[model samples]
Target: MAETSLTELLERNARHVESLDSDHFAGVEDTQAPVAVSICCSDSRVPHDGMWDVTHPGWLFTPSTIGNQVWDIHDGERVVDGSLLYPMINTRTNVTLVVGHTGCGAVSAALDAVQNGPGMVPAGIEKWVDLIVPVVEAGLNDERIDADRDVSLVDQLVEYNVDRQIEFLLESDDVPETETVYGFVYDFQGVYSDERGRAYLVNADGETDVAALRELAPTKYHDAVDRLLQ
Candidate 1:
């Protein structure tokens, strides 16, 4: 069978969007209240809406970046203080999720950078990949991390990157100390996963425990756990 051209694919997809009722916008326009804000990677495989579907429905405001890493600046009153963190905080969303993903091209490139030097990749991509190198290095130092297996290494890197981005979000002023923050990694299959199978949670200190935290605070903790994985 012949593969459809890019133009044909896009034209078909555009028709799908145009078919939606204009009234669909009106139904959501007045209800701008977002219960949570999700920060995830630019990976097309991980859809924010689909992930959030695991939880009860409410409008979720999401901000996506290439690497899902937030950079914090001290000495400012900025809410959601990081570059990608503010939108959710400004919305005063009850929860914030920093989401990374497995098999990320950016992380892979970053690993390549460390192995082959930065010259091998483009300049702009190198900058984004640089953000993840520290996590790669950390994985390298951890005895449990398997540097030999590409899948294991990528998963570890994704988890570590989520932890780092969550820490960055926590530093933001918009993120209340009382407000819950989460870290998650979406796998290639679009299923969220932890160290176990699919989907896990990071505690306030960024430790993974699916059961313990759920037992402590059912509602808030479960929401945090689910959203992070999403």
Candidate 2:
């Protein structure tokens, strides 16, 4: 198979842009009025639009970064803090979602860096990946993950990191208590009833109770919810 050239890629993109009709954006408003703010990983497979089945442009205030790690680094001067605050300030959004996924390269790289040591993966990149070192360590300490078992520590860290990120956001003074925050895990392995890449609610409004979380999970994911609670 021939590799697609930059010219071909640009032409394809231009064609797509030209094909978009006015009707496609007819319902979109000029003002920033979104239902929720979504913080997710920069993984290509898990696009924010598909998570909420978004059809309109302003349905979600999306901010994606490496591993979707949120922290009070540098006294709230980091990009993650600004990204979360931007939607809250500009949009009429009441819900905040911290989403992570299975098969996340960022989480895996962070796991490797923590287990071993930060290697030559560029100075800035290494710093960003190092943010999840605590998460990786927590996952490693979890009694559920046995070294002899087939469990992927990286996947465990992904879910745990989402919980930690949500915890950080909820504790932030900038985040109003009126706004609901949720932590979710996007399962890409069809683990939830053969539906690939479905968003499963792990934490709702800072509550991680199994029963409360079970109430939020879709009926199709009831079995998966049991596994998550286990």
Which has the greatest lDDT? 2
Task: Return the TM-score for candidate 2, rounded to 2 decimals.
Answer: 0.85
Q: Write one digit per residue (lDDT tens) for candidate 1, span 138-171.
A: 7567665566753456666777677767765566
Would you list the C-alpha lDDT of every candidate in the order shown? 0.63, 0.76
Clashes of 1: 2
Candidate 1 least-lDDT 10 residues: 190-199
What stretches of model 1 exceed 4 Å from their correct place? 1-22, 27-31, 54-58, 72-83, 148-151, 189-199, 202-205, 214-230
Q: Please, what is the TM-score per model?
A: 0.70, 0.85
Q: Give the local distance difference test score of model 2.
A: 0.76
* lDDT (10s digit) by residue, model 2, range 1-230: 65889999999999978877777666565566888999888887888998788866778988887888765367546434678777876675889899888878888898888777877888767766877777778877887655564546666667778877887877787777678998888888754347776787778877877676778867766655533424
Candidate 2: deviation at residue 110, Å?
Answer: 1.8
Model 1: how large is the Cα RMSD against the reference? 5.6
Candidate 2: misplaced stretches above 4 Å?
Answer: 1-3, 26-29, 75-80, 191-193, 217-229
